[model samples]
Target: MQPENVRQASYRGVEDPQRLYLAMLQDGEHDAREWLSTQLRRTASMADDLPDDPAQLESWAANHAAQVATDHTRYLTRRHQGAPRHYFANRAHALWFLQQVAPTKVVDGAWLHGVLRHWRDFRFHGLIRTFLEELGDGDPRCNHVLIYQRLLSRLGCDQGLPLDPSRYLQGVVQLALGRHAEHFLPEVIGYNLGYEQPPLHLLITTHELAELGIDAHYFQLHVTIDNAACGHARRALQSLRLLMPGQCAKAFYDRVRQGYRLNDLGIDTPSMIVSFDLEDELLAALQRKRPYGQFMHSDRCRLQGRTINQWLADAEAMPGFLRALEAQQWVRRGEAPSHSRFWTLIDGPQAAMFGVFTAYEKQLLHDWIVGDTAAEDCRRVRPGQWERDLALEQDAPVAQGEVCVDRMIERMWGNRHATPNGLRATRDFIHATGLTRAGPN
Candidate 1:
């Protein structure tokens, strides 16, 4: 039966069963693991194309299936603490974890041509595409769309201000030809922008790090960042602190104490501010061990120097960063912010990851503000009567025109929503414009 070969099944629009099978595992369906294990043995027996020895075949099938399952659990447990709901900071980390769990079909896009010649992964490419799409719709504070637009352009997509959504996530990047290009994710409604570019920060709780199978003894060696002091860089270090293993807490405390006394942050001295260069050092540290957080400090890193005295002042200066930090604790409580929280998530062990998370939030804000450009066009073209018609529509009851009005509301002012303050501004605009609904007349 050999599963009828994927090519043969293509006529029926059927894909390789392995993908469906793997998806089930990823979805955490109750019977997925058990069913996959049983199916492996059956599939092995039915496969006559390979070796004829049933015992060897079954052993191989079982091992492969088990390994796939094991990797999935291992990585998931480490990063997510087995919760599956904990936020991840960046799409790269998510993509990387997915690759580790399943490698067979995760190949490079063909368009990458000879660019990413060393890589191969179709599913990975698709997943990234899907994520970008969902991210645009799901979060108002998203900045990734434009940045990805640039990344896609590098892959040879056409030039444009607003990105072509399809090409941005789906195209292949020619990493071979490029070196150190920075992209901006503009300030959007719900998200506060610290840098036009990313690598905002990484945040990790001590509990999450422990689950990663890292020992606390090497906390200093383990949690290194590219530059310290840039807002994102500073937050990454603080978040990494939560990850200190219980055994290493004393050592961690001692080091921090020593660094404090010496007017240095010890291993964290680098974190006091952002640095301009350190990519090689960063890559080496990550490869050696999972560094707590690494950040692409803002372009300003070149200007900010490392010093404990300097850091205390720097932290005091970034009001947005401070508010963002306070609001994040509230986010854990599921409450709206009383005051604006901007770049707080950019600091902590998970700050880099937090940056990615915040980017999506920012996108949500941007979407809310832009709203319906057509209305603006209509206002210009049709003029006064259309305003009267819009006013008339507002008098209708929710049951009659709620959906349409909601759609109109979103369309007309989506872009105005890049931040909580923006929402207030929109409300003020509505009031000023006399746009409030009167319900059924």
Candidate 2:
């Protein structure tokens, strides 16, 4: 189901990011000029920590790499000494992080959208290669977005959840940049440069996520492909140098700096990681489930002064109800979840409430119950643990509604994701996009 926020009208928040994202993916125009103008204005007063001279990009990248490498070494040393995870508190936190970042993840490589038309131009080759690679060069197995989608699917996060609109801000900016490339080329180059420089958090996140049993391949891919030595970071600098005009070079650099500052505008990875509160998320999950589960229970059991139904009826009293559960012997917090009577009903094969809560809800409850006592049971889904594209293997044409990626691919290039006639249609369409040296999409 589409999240309510996603289905809202355009211009919702910073001009409704979902609509703008959809418009571009559908091969249609949704003027993001006003949105970009507002963002550009926001960054005008922000600090530009990037080197002033574009010629210094190589050294700037090296400095960044050295710093990240040093920090990662320290992080590993701490981990070796048995420090708790620096990012994820538990497996559930890792899944939550993945789901929360879906908006930005799905729009990977959007900033370089405008440069696709210049595929044949050697000057634009760096940017174009980066963009194509983002699309996995049309390979389904390697497509960044699809890989994330599969991760969510395995973890039961594919179904929409109520997400903060602010989560979409960076994605909206990316799509907007793609649509407004003619006016934002320098900005795109600058933004790409900032994004391609692998931060220390990327390394830490990949390791921690893997420790928690989540496939960190997506992040691991970025760590390697976005390396400063000879990866997208290098390519970003090359594109900036190649595209900078001889006339009014200072003005161009000013714009690039402004664009680089644009990276600071959105809710960043650190903020997202710190924002998670397991208890708060559990409360939300309980509230969502309460609506339907309110009357499902028998009136046989009562906690404190209220019956189960009565407690469930009052949404505003959720916190109190949880406290009541803990106050009684019904739930024992800060222990193995299996020890709690409340967890008993929701767990096991023949438990009365076995089917009442979703796998995600069950996970939330488990983590909340475990609390500070969480042990080393970190693995969630092992890599390639589930089969992908079973229907395609069964010789079935993918259902139209289920083919979101293929639908967009078809709209843009009259080809589906998987190909017939021995042609990798998606790859050919994207690679062959630049009909001329610098043509339009």
Candidate 3:
């Protein structure tokens, strides 16, 4: 027999637009790919046309670089002149948006890493520099993704967004496609150029978020790190020149345009902002669960003169279900009802339906049921507060000798010149040291 949770509901049936887009790509859906390629070409045409002469092409890039810097300064000045409308209403609102896009955050660089691995035999210096930066100097803690994770934790959103492919937008999946399609080097580079060039959006986002008292480190990090003047954008252009010096320049540039165009293919930040309707989102979540629960055994649970299955089956029955839950004293309509059974089943550690809903889903339900209209109360931390907090969490009391030994182990693991046997010895030494602890594995 299926587990009660499995029998009652499944997250598998939920529809995700992003997932469908990816599936079409994987299946070699011709029409879809052509449509995407055409769209990319169209978007690229709006920018400067590629030059036939390689030297002229190089000059064009230099000119584009100058324009980008000028544009950045102009936009920053405009923002300082008058604060734009806050992109998010409050901290909670901002956190919700971040959590939604979390799955795709900092992921474009990882795809680039895979593409670079394929070209390792050729030894492109610019590509290698870009890849190393993406790797964060071989320190997992400093990796871009990990940095995003730290920000999430600071916001008390460390639980993470669901890994559902559907959660990602189409433009994000295109980055993965560019990387995975190793033969299409120009396209990959193009994607990198478009992705790395610090757009007006990043600058605006960082400023607006800072004004809202929310930590804007992630956006700020990107604004400087991906700057068109001397950062990833410059590196991406340099890499193109290094990899293919005057060979098939026009063809390569054309492909790069297509890759750049992919950035416009899916849901963007503005779309996310415009589509954020809480009641609609809550209703959609319940609807996604409706199919699985429709056939559930009603004998096990009943509410509102109907079985749990019946309550779930009707799209318009949620208000009635809530009323029934309130009638049974299982929910409090206008407060954080931690003691509510319905809440527990949806969110608790030992919940019958644990692992089914995402953090965002649970949050939506909590807000809806509580009728929460309260403003965000989370206090703003300073620029480096999250980093300081992380250091504190990682620091612990230990013997001086043990600390030295741990550092030695880390150094050994990081050494590129260390022999296999030497590395093995370092690992074994750490394991042996662990034997001193009193615990059963």
Candidate 4:
């Protein structure tokens, strides 16, 4: 079957395989009855009909690489020639866009982690090596996810980690779901290819963000790491050859194509750029947080005709709510109105609605109402922070003298294999002994 056909088939019977898989977990579905696992198995079964031909498989891989390379060159040339408008209009625009897409970026290869673990568990060394390289040999500092996080932090974009899956773009969801299912290895590899293949978006993003004065290290890193000639893209192709040699070739290629096609299913950079409406996004952000804060205030707190609770209830009603507040002279736009009651509630420390929105969320609201003319200072960090944060603890304190039991316990507690539960139990045991720091009682 054609790769596009396979992707369409995979999603045909499900409303959204990504959401459905999440629901199945919440519903405690397990083993064969589990929706996610069932889907994985069904996907894997699709390749069962392909005949394994090693020569044909090698030819397909070469052709895939050549085609991808040609496409990459053509895209780059076209983008450069056209000199299209920046994906983000300015620094603020870039920051908001990054914050919106940060979740997907931060969890770069999380789904692949499952596949890596599976390979390790089953002693598939070839697969293990391929995935391990992607993970930078399990180094936390060098890990792509951590690198992205550092970029986010450096830019003062504090969206935090593990964002809600619902916030992800459909394309991001497709890539993630493909990796996570772990049923079709070929498809996952295909996804790796599609994802890692040097794209025009990364180049444009890096250049545009740099022009906007935001650190584009994350994009820059990916450009180098996923280079089609000598990086993850090349490695991904090599992996297919290594893992699916001989009789497994045909089936693997079929699934890989499907996974590759999945990359085309979601929003692309240019599309997101064109679709981003700051006003609409601000309203939507407030709306998402509305239900949680709807009953926060009573009728007595009504500013014009509606209570604070009433204003927070509906997204469509919010503009009118703001207008009402303006009519009551409670808020003044286009300036930092420290005395504005609504602004105070949305952004103040001691306000009743504190901690309700994210920094990015507040930034959006602040920019929308107050305008982007305010002189906002960028949060700067030391260049060494990334290296310092990721530095490996390579040594333990050596005991020169005869070790006491407490010292021994402490040493044992610090071992890498010590679990949190085990450490807690050990601490309890120590406390129960009534031993003071000076001596045992």
Which lDDT values do the candidates have, in the order given?
0.25, 0.73, 0.56, 0.53
Candidate 1 lDDT tens digits, 148-171: 222233222222122112111111
lDDT of 4 at 70: 77
Writing each residue's lDDT as its tens digit, candidate 4 over 133-237 gives 433433445445556666777666764523334344332343344335456566666666566666556777776676666666667767787765666766666
Off by over 4 Å in 3: 1-86, 90-92, 114-123, 150-182, 208-214, 285-315, 319-378, 387-441
- TM-scores for every candidate against the unseen true structure: 0.18, 0.85, 0.59, 0.60
User: C-alpha displacement of 372 in model 2, angstroms?
Assistant: 1.4
Model 3 poorest 10 in a row by lDDT: 1-10
Residue-by-residue lDDT tens digits, candidate 2, 146-263: 6777778877888867777677777878877876778898899888888888888789989998887777888888999898888888888888889999999999999998787677
RMSD vs true structure, all candidates: 26.8, 7.1, 12.6, 10.9
Model 2 residue pairs with clashes: 11-15, 11-16, 12-16
Q: Is candidate 2 or candidate 3 better by lDDT?
A: 2
The whole-model C-alpha lDDT of candidate 4 against the native structure comes to 0.53
**Candidate 4 local Cα displacement, residue 435, angstroms:** 45
Q: In candidate 1, residue 159 scores what lDDT? A: 26
Instruction: By lDDT, rank the candidates, best first.
Output: 2, 3, 4, 1
